[model samples]
Target: MQQGSGSLVELLLSADNFYELVSTIQYLDVIQSRNSEAVSELVSLTDELALTQASLNAQMDEAEAEKQRADEARDEAEEARDQLEAKIAAQAAAEAAARKAAIEAAQRAAELAAQSEQQTPTFTTESGNDATVEVPDLPDPDIVVPDSDKDAFVSEWSARIDAYLAGSPLAGQGTTFAEAAWEYGCDPRLSPAISTVESSTGRVCFLPHNAWGWGSSSWSSWEEAIWAHVAGLAAGYGGQLTYAGAQKYCPPNADAWYASVLANMLSI
Candidate 1:
């Protein structure tokens, strides 16, 4: 029925209908054009949004990579710091141990020196001549036979002592003692002197194995004494000792004790 009514109105209003139809056609055309433009703008905006999203994703990836790199660097730095700290700790420990050992050695030496006055020092020489001597004792007659008459004394005593030790026991019996004395590479006359001076004229040295004044308890045997003696002489006289710069072992006075000790060796 509504369609029939619209048909009757169309037939009755011809001129009015033409004008209305033209206006409606013009409005529809404008509306359709505006709608098309809006659709195109929307599509363009969507493309731009997609591009922006892609760019944001790339930036996020780069930022994540940078963060990962920074974290790795921090971890490496921490590891390096830890290693340095460990090395420092180890060095400190080693220094402490060295200091402790030095302290212990010094203490032992002090104790030994204090307790060894009453007892005599004793040890066998490399030449196989064994005689007990007192610490800081009177001079032996054999050693007292002056250096000027040293040759004759050496010849006479060497022959006698060699015979006694090697089974002769006669002064002019044979020259075996002289040969043994010579074999020891040190003077036989000086040997008695060394013993007497250190062991106290057959009384006591009481220091463990320091009979010939050759060692200070750190040395163990006669061989060590011999080597130490030889080395000491060369080094002491030739300015080879580390402490004695530009001068040999001979120094004046008891104040320079290390040097004085070096000089006294010749007397022994």
Candidate 2:
């Protein structure tokens, strides 16, 4: 393949933008072989020069052999030293380049791994309400009535439906309304059941784990919603709010009423 830019060595040697240097090292071995051939060629050239000097000496007499030997020795030593030094320098440069490339690749890998960890989102849930941790699907976006709100239960449930569809942040802000309702002496089940009564099968504003239409219930931020339900009931659910003497004010089926209100709280 054609190299897009500089020499293979230059591209492979860069520390910050290097890859494939190891594979290219084998190519260096080939270059070393070529360097060896260069040494052979230089030796042959020296021999040819010596033969020329010897031929020139054939035109002279006596101590000519000694003179030629001395001159040839000096040239041979200098030339051999130059070639050895140049070969060593080239090898050292290539090795340094390869090592720098490897180190940069490793550092890049580490940086990418760190970035991956930072990018991944971590889910979080408030404490004490395990249901929030494993909430199922969110309910439908809108809950419509069955062409009427004439029934007493339907009308009462309808009021809370507005709050649920509003996606009130009070409960989701931190507190499970159940704890709030329980603390304020209102049945926790009442909220979720209001949702069911208004929007059966989670069709109306199907929020998950929020039966009370509160989305999330917490007394800390949603003290008003909690107190509202309490005060609303205290104003007299069917003329009297007190739980005592409940038999007189409540319909004949008190157990069934709370059941239909917050079915999820039936176990509670």
Candidate 3:
């Protein structure tokens, strides 16, 4: 009976062990199921993190591209501005240089005029009397226009004078000479003919603006010299063209001078 009881207890313990083993196996299965769910969740989270990282990287690259474009645009704008400023500065400098050159030219012209004014000539009357002829302060050339009588005289003689002086330095002064002759009651052809004889129509002169070789004279401008010489001729030579006048004017070569002057007057 004791052996039978021991056998029954061993069977009961074995059955309990079998029940515990079954319970432990079911717990392990539950743990495995939970672990599988957790692993799926972790894998899903890792995939989501990788996607987020990829999106961040793409955004960063786009932002970098935008910054580079903005930088390039800024550089282009700066370059354009610099080129525009340089052009403006160059134009201003050129204008300033032109103004400086004009001022220098005007100053030089004034200096030459002042130098000429320092040397002038004295005149002699037909009666062999020495005289200091004062130049009339004539009106400016811009303001002076010939009247009807002077205009007629200029029209008649201007073309002739221009033709005679075409290749000479005294070219283009026909109207000035004609107008001065009319104003001073001198022969229009007398002064120009004398210029041809003495100074080769102002191609050469012993003094500044002394085209007629009247004396040791210098004038600031040709207009002033023309008027002064005409006035002197009217004062001393009776404003006429004559052999007597030529003899009194240049006794050393009166015949040749008079003949040349007559021929020039006839040609005119």
The best candidate in terms of lDDT = 3
Query: Clashing residue pairs, candidate 3?
Result: none
> What tens-digit string does per-residue lDDT give for candidate 2 at 71-125?
8998999999999999989876754453344334334444565688753221111
Best by TM-score: 3
What stretches of model 1 exceed 4 Å from their correct place?
Answer: 1-18, 115-268
Determine the backbone clash count of candidate 3: 0
Candidate 1, 1-268: lDDT as tens digits:
1123354346334335667666655655787799999999999999999999999999999999999999999999999999999999987676445434433433444456569754332233322333332221111111221245546755775554444324211223224323334443334333333333344322344444344444454355433443454344334433121223212221221112222222232333
Worst 10-residue lDDT window for candidate 1 reads 134-143
Candidate order by decreasing TM-score? 3, 1, 2
Candidate 3 lDDT, 52-165, residue by residue in tens: 999999999999999999999999999999999999898757644543443343344445556888433333332233222222121111112335676677887777777887
Backbone collisions counted per model: 21, 14, 0
Instruction: Order the candidate numbers by lDDT, best to worst.
Output: 3, 1, 2
* TM value for model 3: 0.44
User: Which of the two candidates, 1 or 3, achieves a greater TM-score against the reference?
Assistant: 3
| lDDT against the true structure, each candidate | 0.42, 0.41, 0.65
- For model 2, the superposed segments whose C-alpha errors exceed 4 Å read 1-62, 118-268
- Residue 77, model 2: Cα distance from true site in angstroms: 2.1
* lDDT score at residue 265, model 1, on the 0-100 scale: 25
